[model samples]
Target: MTSSFHFRPMVLMASSLALLAGCTSSPRTPAPVEDRTTMGRSSTPTATPAAEAPKPLPGSENAGKPGYYTVQRGDTLTRIGLDNGQGWRDLARWNNLTNPDLIEVGQVLRVSPPGGAVETSGVVVRPIASSGPSSSVTTQDNAGNKEPTKESASKPNANANAQAMQFIWPSQGKLISKFDANNKGIEIAGKKGDPVLAAESGKVAYVGESLRGYGKLILIKHNGYLTAYGHNDKFSVKEDQLVTKGQKIAEMGNTDADAYKLKFEIRDTAGKALNPVTLLPQR
Candidate 1:
């Protein structure tokens, strides 16, 4: 009976150790796979778009050409004539415009005469005389008597004649502003209804408020030069009329200005503004 009990205990112990070894030797089940389909996607960032360039102004293609002008917005026939040193009537005839007021933006205009030829019908061409003091030229007559010749007394000097152009003050007032790139002219302080005289003798090319920032403006054409009178209360002269130096052309007022004043400017035929102080007489 004792041998049988010992044999049974040894069998039970061996069976327990065999079961533990089998449990350790068996492979463990893999973990459940994670579901990545519901997670947010990661991607590279998108690039930003560039800004667009500004468009060019109308009629810019014909710019910088001599003897030709590209009509811009707010352009008038009279203003164009003054800028090109041509009369408004002449411009009307050259362009064959029935209505001088109707001009389109981007339209190309002939600023100079076609083929460099000017129409001289019914126009008188007088020779310019020298600016020097006049002197009598004497010639011996047939009877040994000295006589002054009337045919060839004056000599032509174009440069001297051009330099002899004189200008006067448009108003008798204190100067409020000087000419500059931004101003384009000088400002003269005056009372309302003050007389605005012409700075030089010329025909009236424009007399209206069509141009912006120049209310009741008057543009006078002086040969190859142009004078502008702005901010007027009343006009005393008409277009195409001849005006004398120091003659009243308009009345000064606060039109397009901060105070009652006269805005005067001088320009060349190419639309370049010149200093009025240099042209006008000293105060």
Candidate 2:
């Protein structure tokens, strides 16, 4: 009985050790896989979008005739008129514009007179015809009474200065040069910085240095008539501004000239050059 009890205790202890070894030898299951692919909420920056360009205005070119002008980007009323050689005020008046600065891009505006007709407001009176006393004509009426007919009749020469715009001296200076075949205008000598006046009431058409040999110039328009003042040192009036006769518009200078002077000109409604002396009042 004692030998059997010892053998049974040894068997029980071996079975307990086998169970513990099996538990340690078996591989442990891998821990739950971590979600390493997930990232933070913040992100990288991207490029910004670019701005769009302005659209171009549309129109056609018809020189010296009634036509339309398209208002383009960076275009003002004065700039449009200057480019077309039309006065800003005249353009505004012709288009019935109540506000000159309210022009918009892509807007069409009138640039000529209605029906392309030349405006004439002045009357030309003809000189009386001289006749000898014996050249009188007699007309006999139905009642047998003789009556003398009228001799001198006044008529207008439409081709002559019938609607010419009158002008005055642009500056109180000595006439240094007169208009000639070689020159389209006259030059008046004056001191530097002398006041330059407008020859007639009109709208400021152009004000810039675009024209060669005319430094710092200002162009004015009177109806169909156009006047130019050149070699100015300073401009008092801007483009599109209304100026009256004798108004100080600029300062005389020697820009593009050998001496200080003012270059003045008078152009017809069609841009033909005219003698300034004929239009200007006698000094």
Candidate 3:
């Protein structure tokens, strides 16, 4: 017959889509996914099985809010995603990391606001035992406590790093530099993509690319504490991810490093950066 105008129907359809978006619960990260199967064809989703309840997503009722992630044995970044309502891709993106399949025990991860986050190398979960005043009193004491010596502080136990710190090394390497109050972090050198361990056990709060001197950075948060790793070849976990002690959270080797070194920083609940030499084990 004659050509007819039908602008109202298009407007109604667009309005309906906007309404639906406003009504449903959203996910931490949503992306455009292609639908390969058409009306005549069907295919199973590549996601984890539905029978096993997926892990809670960050901020969801199922996913525990930003907090500590206790790294258990046999934990992997992929498993953490499935457990925390995240996927491998999103996890890596959140943590500013490059890998997703590898993660280890006793590592801590922190999930932070958009734009910045921290990841601890070799994260630990348990709190450190405040062994009442040390028998050896020395120069300074926070509260009549004996001054911890560099000798003792150099080699904070690996078990202790897990039990107390909840994080571990970003990679197996020697400490090339110490955490200086003026400088603010320690330096480590290792191979490219070397497994960086987590230092504490916590949820991944944030992961980003804005690390200045640090090439590729990962940030994590623990109970009233935070850790950061920079100049990495890649990251291992995502925001709101739960990790354990000695977990592989990132790969070593500076993105801008001539020698492929790592920059490590730790902060307290008060956001005060602390000297890692006070608690790390001797190299």
Model 1 Cα displacement at 243 (Å)? 1.6
What's each prediction's clash count? 0, 0, 87
Least well predicted 10-residue stretch by lDDT in candidate 2: 119-128
TM-score of 2: 0.50
Give candidate 3 misplaced runs (Cα > 4 Å): 1-163
lDDT of 2 by residue, 4-95 (tens): 98999899999999999999999989899865545553456557998898665323233223467777788877656655556666678887
Name the candidate that leads on TM-score.
1
| TM-score on alpha carbons, each prediction | 0.64, 0.50, 0.44
Instruction: Report lDDT per candidate.
Output: 0.78, 0.76, 0.61
Model 3 poorest ten-residue lDDT run = 56-65
Across 248-270, the per-residue lDDT of candidate 1 in tens digits comes to: 99999888878899888887766
- TM-score head-to-head 1 vs 2, winner: 1
Sorted on TM-score, highest at the top, how do the candidates line up?
1, 2, 3
Q: Write candidate 3's Cα lDDT for 1-283 as tens digits.
A: 2333477778899999998887775655778787665645656546676697766533243233354354577765543543343333445666555655444454454333244333343334455665555544356666776664542333345444334653445556778887664777788777777788777666666565543466776766665456777887777887768877678888776575568888887766434577776656655
The weakest ten consecutive residues by lDDT in model 1 span 118-127
Return the clash pairs for model 1, or none: none
Q: When superposed on Cα atoms, how far off is each prediction in RMSD?
A: 11.8, 10.4, 26.1
